[model samples]
Target: MNRRTLIIVTAVVAVGLFAIGGLLYSPTSKEVAVTKPVSNEAPLVRPHSPVFGAKDAPVTIVEFFDPACEACRAFHPVVKKILSEFQGKVRVVLRYTAFHPPSEEAIRILEAARLQGKFEVVLERLLETQPRWAPHGRPADSAWSLLDGTGLDVERARRDAKLPGIVAVLNQDTADVKNVGVTGTPTFFVNGKPLLDFGAQQLLDLVEAEVASN
Candidate 1:
């Protein structure tokens, strides 16, 4: 081969290897999810689960997610996009599956935000600043500071987060998570059907199909 051709070939191979290495080391690659056929819908939604769309929407996406989960953080935008595309026809119900130790604290903060009717705002702030607080195995203590300008009364949220009611919400969701056979974060259920073939496209397709059927 000519010197120029060999150089180009080497560069292309390097790029390909780099891309492959990125995929292998990505946080999503380490996520372990186990989904069983959902025959019962009762455990999917509770009255207190955070809902992020029209309450009467025909299609429901129940997401069991951990706030500190990297995979869940990565999929946040995808979930938002789906909600936007299916506006008024689809709703997202957030189920806190606090798989990470730090996740319970985040979930408590979210539950507190929900009390002040600022769930979505606080949720967006947390996800946007996830890397700062939640860095893999480390504790997400910095997550509290990231919510400063989200209009959530931090003092009040702190107090409310310890309430029995808040604990009840967490406990109930934990039980439902086990009942529904969810073993990981970002597990989605579209119209009571589990997304067995997992992927962003698969989730979108499932939502689209449910929306069309309804």
Candidate 2:
């Protein structure tokens, strides 16, 4: 081959290799792991209450969930069971990620309930009746029905739902989800480490080990 032709071919090959390397090594936004505190360094707890043991417990389980998610509803019973089994040994913090319309409304109601200091009671009732209330692709009315039985004054609950402070709390939760890089519902963090592909039992086991270590 002529010298110029050979040089041109080599240049083309070099460019092709560079393009391939870039595709292979470039870091995309989705590839990044969410950074969070390893343990006690986490910031102030949000307005919502943690499930399971006392606030001062040795082990903490933080869950990011969407209320209208069927998977989340399926996990509700197991979560309650975990709280009951662990009692005072662990604490479960639930952060709302309203990924859908119904879930958004449900979160608003839950936040409103918080204003009345009945958040836990309302949450339990919602979980217990989630199937009836949170059917797939349904509207927010079912959740409202469950809230009706929370013993919170209906007028106060409605008013609080629209309160500026409660809206701010909900927005904070959304920001937390973004900061944590959570892509879906029911994501869990044990002692601040991501629990990828782990089941509820595995999660509990990790919590127990952490408690034992501490």
Candidate 3:
């Protein structure tokens, strides 16, 4: 090849090599940000949520509970005993995890009772009568009939159950249930720590650990 041709070929090859190097090592102008899906699982406790035991208790047991769950019914007394034992050291924040036909209606009834300052009594009554009213696949309307004259203004509660506030509460709790990975009723979270293995004793142990830590 002629000298000029040789020089031109060398220049082109050098330019190609530089371009390849630039591609290999240059900082990219276009930033591809791969964002991961963030968890929306906030605190299980909300302002409108149902709380039992001392309001100022340092430790909080957040239970993702379904009113229709027979297991939840059984755990009621055990939870009560734990609260009695913990007393001022812990409180429970109940979030609805309505996994059955009667669960949502039962929550609505309980909230209606809350509106009428009868939450505790109505909750007790419903838990006590859950077998009759919350049996598997039970229609919600039949359960509503049972709530009548419980000092809840049952007719009014049936109406109020459709109210925006109660609905929003239920919807939010349902979303939280999925977000927090709750697959069953009576799922417990002690101060944001999930009960990895579920049992009455596990719950008590977690609560005691949290209470002691606080």
lDDT of each: 0.77, 0.65, 0.71
Selected candidate, larger TM-score, 1 vs 2: 1
For candidate 3, list the clashing residue pairs, or say none.
Answer: none
lDDT of 2 by residue, 102-198 (tens): 7777888887877788878887777667767666655434677666666887677878788887787788888877867777767777777766634
Candidate 3 Cα errors over 4 Å, as ranges: 1-41, 137-141
Best by TM-score: 1
lDDT for 42 (candidate 1): 71
Query: What is the total number of backbone clashes in candidate 3?
Result: 0
TM-score of every prediction relative to native = 0.81, 0.74, 0.76
65-94: candidate 1 lDDT, tens digit per residue: 898876676666667767878899999998
Which order, best to worst by TM-score? Answer: 1, 3, 2
Q: What's the lDDT for residue 73 in model 1?
A: 68
Residues 17-115, model 3: lDDT tens digits? 444542111111112121222233364777888899999999888877888876666566667767888999999999998988778888998888899
Candidate with best lDDT: 1
Rank order by lDDT, top first? 1, 3, 2
